[model samples]
Target: MKVQVKSFFSVLSGGKPVVRTLDLQEGTTAEDAMKLMKVDFSDGAIILINGRPSNEKSVLSEGDFFVVMPPVSAA
Candidate 1:
């Protein structure tokens, strides 16, 4: 299965949005994919799957768009 991952305002790309493709096995969870990419969940990023709000435990499917973005601040 292939999953498209996008990280916005993330450490992975020096706070820039970076899109990448991950070739994973069937039954890969969103958290698992993040781990593969070395995402730091401790930074408190919002997880979105195909633009829908999701969590780390969310299961991933083929052609799924897994997005990680830092929480927006008023400042």
Candidate 2:
């Protein structure tokens, strides 16, 4: 399966917004995907799969668009 990953606010490996494509096997979990992308989960992040709220245990399907973003807070 092909998964598209987008990371915002330096939540991903490079510490910068990035768009990447990762090919994963069937039934890959969101958390596993995040780990593969090197995301920092300590601060708590939001997962959106196909524009809907998703959790780490959510299973992905082919051609899924997944986004990992830092938690939003108003100052």
Candidate 3:
């Protein structure tokens, strides 16, 4: 199964977009994909599965879309 992963930051920063397509086996967890992408969840990153908040261990299915966002703060 193939999943689309998208990472976006605020538009004000004008940073490069982070996006990738990953091929994973059935029963792959969100944590597994994160590891494959070398993303550390502990860095205040939030994961959403199909537009809903999901935990690292949440199981993923075919055509799953993951949106990862960094923590927001007020300066």
Candidate 4:
């Protein structure tokens, strides 16, 4: 299965394009996906699956779109 990954922080891909494609198993969890992208989950990043907030344990399906970003802050 294929998933689309959109990252909001450079840490996901060393400041490269925020979008990338990942090929994973059907039952792959969000954490697994992040790992595939070489993203560090310990950063307290926020993840959203199909525009809905989700956790690392959440399982992802084929063609699902997920966004990863660092926690937002106000100045």
Against the true structure, whose lDDT is highest? 2
Q: Which of the predicted structures, 1 or 3, would earn the higher TM-score when compared with the native?
A: 1
* TM of each candidate vs. truth: 0.82, 0.84, 0.78, 0.83
Which model is ahead, 1 or 2, in terms of lDDT?
A: 2
User: What are the Cα lDDT values of the candidates?
Assistant: 0.85, 0.87, 0.81, 0.85
Cα RMSDs of all predictions?
2.2, 2.4, 2.7, 2.3
Error of 3 at 29 (Å): 0.7
- Give lDDT tens digits, candidate 3, residues 1-75: 999988764332676657899999999998888878766667666889999998888898999999777766789
Name the runs in model 2 displaced over 4 angstroms: 9-16
Evaluated against the true structure, the overall lDDT of model 1 is 0.85
Ranked by lDDT from best down, the candidates are 2, 4, 1, 3
Looking at candidate 3, what is the lDDT of residue 65?
Answer: 97
Summed backbone clashes in each candidate are: 0, 0, 0, 0
Least well predicted 10-residue stretch by lDDT in candidate 3: 8-17
Question: How would you encode candidate 1's per-residue C-alpha lDDT over 1-75 as one tens digit per residue?
Answer: 989999774654656777899999998998898888777877567999999999988999999999987766786
| Candidate 4 residue lDDT tens string, 41-61 | 785789999999999999999
Q: Identify the runs in model 3 with alpha carbons over 4 angstroms from their true place.
A: 9-14
Per-residue lDDT for 1-75 in model 2, tens only? 899999884643466688889999998998998898888777778999999999999999899999989887899
